[model samples]
Target: MVSVTENTEQKIIDAACKVFIQKGMDGARMQEIADEADINKALLHYYFRSKSKLFDRVFVEIFSDIVKLLGEEINHSTEIIELIERMVNNYIHLIRERPFVPDFVLHELNRHPQLIVQQIHQYGMDFSKFQLLIDEGVLNNKIHYIQPVHLIVNVLSMCIFPFVAKPIIMGFMLNGDEAKYNQFIDERAGHVVSFIKSSLLINNPE
Candidate 1:
């Protein structure tokens, strides 16, 4: 039950997203997006006043999608190790598919950090539950004592740093071979999970 107007708007948004992901804001052209959407540039401009406006729309949705994704996945579960594994794997897969989202988001975030605060307020994000889970794990001797913030930072760094530094990583480590770099990213997910587990889990001597 989609109206033609809404459908056309969505088509424009979809085409814009692809172009933005490929070339980012500076390089994305309205005519290119129009061609991709099979619409005329004039019609595209009618829907979105300018490329910046289109980019803003796409960027905001990307942020919202990421926020929703994190909110959905970070539900507190008893199986902390499994959760870590899932988190790492999910992020790597997502970044691999997009390949441009990580750097693009960070670049935009540097320009508009307040946008994140605004969305946080809008979403009423809750970290208290996850904090409680970490506290319980420490008390139960399930993992080494660590602050929730530190643990979160560590996990995110492991999951995100490689993707953020993809060009350098690929250039230096994989010798600019995209397939090799992709394989490295894929394998790094499991390695990160195991690395976190090893660091957090305490061994009791017999």
Candidate 2:
């Protein structure tokens, strides 16, 4: 039940995301985005006043989904290990679906760190539940004592680094074979989950 206007807007947004991922904000042109969307430049400009505005739209659209997913995972998971597994699997799938997201966000992080921080704050993401899970695990002797910050950062780094460094990883590790690279990415979630569990759980066999 997508209206024509909504569909057109989504088309523009999707086109903009692709161009931004490929050329980044500095190199992407409005006309190119219009061409990608199969729309006239005038219509594109009418919808989005400028490239920066369009870029912001794309970033917010993608980042908001990521923040939402993370917030849900933190809120709903009862155990730290379950949270870790869900986070790794979900995060990896998200990045794989939006392959340009990690690089775009990383670039923006360096360029507009404050803006990213503001968006996360606006999302109202609370880590108290995550920390509580960690503390509970430690108290129950199910996992080793570790700061939630460290664990959170470690898990995030592991999940994001592969996608952020995709080109290098694919070239160096998989000899630029796209199929094997994808397979590596597919297997990465389980590897990350196992690694984190091994580090945190006292009875981890792997």
Per-candidate clash tally = 0, 0
Candidate 2 per-residue C-alpha lDDT over 1-206 given as tens digits, one digit per residue, 9 for 90 to 100: 12355578888998887888788778899889999888998888788887778888887876787888999998889999999999999999878887777888788778867658668668987988888998999899999988888888899999999988889998998999999988988899999998888888998887
The candidate that achieves the highest TM-score relative to the unseen native structure = 2
lDDT values of the candidates? 0.78, 0.85
Q: Summarize candidate 1's per-residue lDDT along 105-139 as a digit string, tens digits.
A: 88777876765776778677676756777777788
Check candidate 1 and list the clashing pairs. Answer: none
Off by over 4 Å in 2: 1-7
Model 1: residues with Cα > 4 Å off, grouped in runs: 1-6, 204-206
